[model samples]
Target: MIESWRWYGPFDKITLPEIAQTGATGIVTALHEIPYGEVWPSALVASRNGEIRAAGFDWVVVESLPIHERIKRGEGDLSELFANYRQSMANLAANGVKTICYNFMPLLDWTRTDLTAPVARGGSCLRFEAAKMAAFEIHMLGRAEAEADYTPEALQMAAIWFQKASETDRDALLHAIMSGLPGAFDRYDIAGLRQALKGYEGIGRADLRANYQRFLDEVVPAAEDLGMALCVHPDDPPRDILGLPRIVSSGADITWVLNAVDSPANGLTFCTGSLGANPTNDLPALARQFADRVHFAHLRNVRKDPDGSFEEAAHLEGDTDMAAVIAALLDEQKRTGRIIPFRPDHGHELLWDAEKGTHPGYPLIGRLRGLAELRGVIAGLRHRD
Candidate 1:
């Protein structure tokens, strides 16, 4: 597997040179400064590649070529947006960058309720609390249909939780979900969220899936023509949020997309943390089943509760069977004869990183520990095989 690190361009707290010290040979990044619907110029891509090369690393993956909101909802001048996306793909291919990771989630990219949930080891991890999210949706954002999405008991709990929450807690919850953390693409407050939710008022699961299918139909061929792989990321929690439907959250959903496009260029970003949030998703089985289609991977673990809340766990210590999953990935690598680019996704804030202040789930020390652990697992699996 090709070990990689996600860098949020020049503004990231952890510089490219600092990342090099962790032994990651490849950089997974995007031109975050570029607006969503604009064409990514070939010159800009080359400049970014040059920066990475100068830092003694190769740019292996474009973590995202963001699908515009208009494209995701099937709204407003889609032909123009699709044209820009295709042009961006051509630019990346022209610059020798092949793998592109993106998501089709409507409002937010990935969300959490707590950015500093306490771990037993005295570090902090990102957490998603279902009731708190419900609280925000019901009492804060005042989504009229929010109650229908939650059970009576859950709704009651959320209301009570909202009543007891302090103003700081309320702000923190809002910031965690809507504002803070990397990859939100845009920030939102209560009014902004209410306005954003309005965009998906009539859109449901089936409609969202159809829109994504349409997107695939339009872009997959372009990606194939350029010999580039487009890997779609799964929903962060692998479920619906804020009354919006999540189309890419399950095996059936994945099957639908793969069959919808049916091209080698249309692929998956196998994120264990996201998929494993739902207990029904068998990590190792999914890895083996979609081995051929997985172009990039984000390997992290989460400890899930029965009530739909979860917190990031150490890479090897969560509900996910890391050993079995790694074995399956190794088998797939052998079968395909292609190096899979996998990164240690969403680590805790630990050691000096906790004090130094870093992106919510992207502290340097924590991820280094995760990468070292995953690397050891791969080494051991190869030795056994």
Candidate 2:
């Protein structure tokens, strides 16, 4: 693996020099300051790339180039939006970044009911509790079709849970669920959020996948021409929340993406943690099947609970067979003779590190432990080979 770290941008407390100390040579970053659906100017791209190089890291991958809601809805100025995305790919390419990781979930990029669930290891970590989520959907946000998404047992639990939420808890849950989006949850009021969710109103997974294919058809050519790989990120939480469709949550999803554009330029960011949230996702097996297209990876795990429940786990200790995941990744590298870019993603906030106020899981000590674990696995695999 070409071990890497995800850098949030210039304002991030975790500096690139600090990232270099972690031993990762590649930087997985994005032009977050730029607005969505607009072209990323070559100048802005060069500035960030130059900074990473100056700090002793390679601008190797982009964590994302967000697809606008307008394009997802196949609504307003979608042609122009897609064209801008294509041009953004071109700009990122001009700066020598080769891979782009993006997702297709509507409205929310990812959803978690509890941003600070107390973990067994002690410090607070992100979690998704079905009960809290249901309360948000039914009582707080009042999303239509909320009850139908759950089983009778979950609905019953949610009904009781909703009754007990303090007004503050309910509001907090709403903010957390709608926390991060294209413009970073800037439009999260119930009515607007509902409208955004409804924009996919009649749209199903199949419909969304088709739209994604069309979007790719418009831009993958640009990626190919620029010698860039577009690695689509899997859905975080990996489940349909609030009755919304999730197209990037499964092996089949990756297959669909590959079939959309049969080229090395079209690839996958095999995030074990995101896909592992679904008990059905066989991480090792999926890794083996999609190895060729996996140009980027997020190595993390989640310990799943009953009724849409889960909390982030240590990178090596989560429910995912992280050993097998790493083994597969290393095997892929040996087979291809090329190191794939990987970042130990979404770590728990830990002691001493909590005082810094870093981006969710981008803390130093937590990910240092994770990277060490993953590095050990990689070394073991190599020695055996």
Candidate 3:
């Protein structure tokens, strides 16, 4: 596995020089400045690649080249959006960046109820509490059909949570969930969220799956031709939320997605943190089963609760058997002699991380610690061989 770090382009609080000192040679990033559904010109792609190279690191993967909502919803004529996406892939390939990681989660990218849930270790980690999420959807967002999505027990819990939550708590929950949308701070509100949810009114699991297949049919071939791999990231939390369908959240779903467009370019971004949120995922087994099709990996772990609450755990300490997963990936690399680029994802905010005020789950020291721990695991595993 090639070690990589996700950098949110020029504006990221963690600079390239600081990243270079982390011992990672590969950079996983995207041209976040460009709006979704826009073509990334070859020159701009080349410039970004040059910027990484100048910092003594290789841009190994495009963390995402976002899919337009129109494309995801299978809405009206998306020929232009499809064209833009293909062009972006071509541009990225032209600049020698071949692996692309993206997700098809509706409305929100990755939902969490708390961005700074304190842990026993005195550090903070991202968390998702089921009742709180239910509270937000039921009492806060006031989605009419939200109650139908939860069980009677869950509804009661949510009601209690909503009743007990103060104005500040409610506001924080709203911010945490809404902030998952890109540029949400500027445009997101209760009305905006309701409007967004309205778009998916008639769409369900099958509809979203069909839309994803349509997207693959359109762009996978282009990616293959460009010698690129388009890897779809697993839905964060790996479950239904906001009454929206999450198609890419399990082994069966991943198998269906890979089979939709049978090509090396049509692949999976094996995200442990996301997949591990679901207790039944069996991370090591899934890693072994999908090893050949995995183009990138988000190596992190999570502590899951029976009630669907979860928090980002230390890279190696959660329910996921990190060593076993890494071992499977290592075996795949050995079998095919192909390198899988992976990054330590969603690290806890520790040391000076809280003070730096970096993006949630993206503090410098926290990720550095995760990387070091993961690197040590890899080394120890290899030493046994």
**In each prediction, how many residue pairs overlap at the backbone (N, C-alpha, C within less than 3 A)?**
0, 1, 0
Q: lDDT tens string, model 1, 5-76?
A: 999886588999899999999999999888788999999999999999999988999988988887778887
Greater lDDT among 1 and 2 belongs to: 1
List, residue by residue over 217-252, the lDDT tens digit for candidate 2.
998888889998988889987878767788888888
Best first by lDDT, ranked = 3, 1, 2
**Candidate 3, residue 63: lDDT:** 77
Stretches > 4 Å off in candidate 3:
182-187
Per-model CA lDDT versus the true structure? 0.89, 0.82, 0.89
Give the 10-residue window scoring lowest on summed lDDT in candidate 3. Answer: 178-187
Clashing residue pairs, backbone N/CA/C < 3 A, model 1: none
Clashes of 1: 0
Our model 2 lands, by Cα RMSD against the true structure, at: 1.6
Q: Pick the candidate with the highest lDDT.
A: 3
Q: Once model 2 is optimally superposed onto the true structure by TM-score, how far is the C-alpha of residue 217 displaced, in angstroms?
A: 0.6
Cα displacement (angstroms), candidate 3, residue 44, comes to 1.6
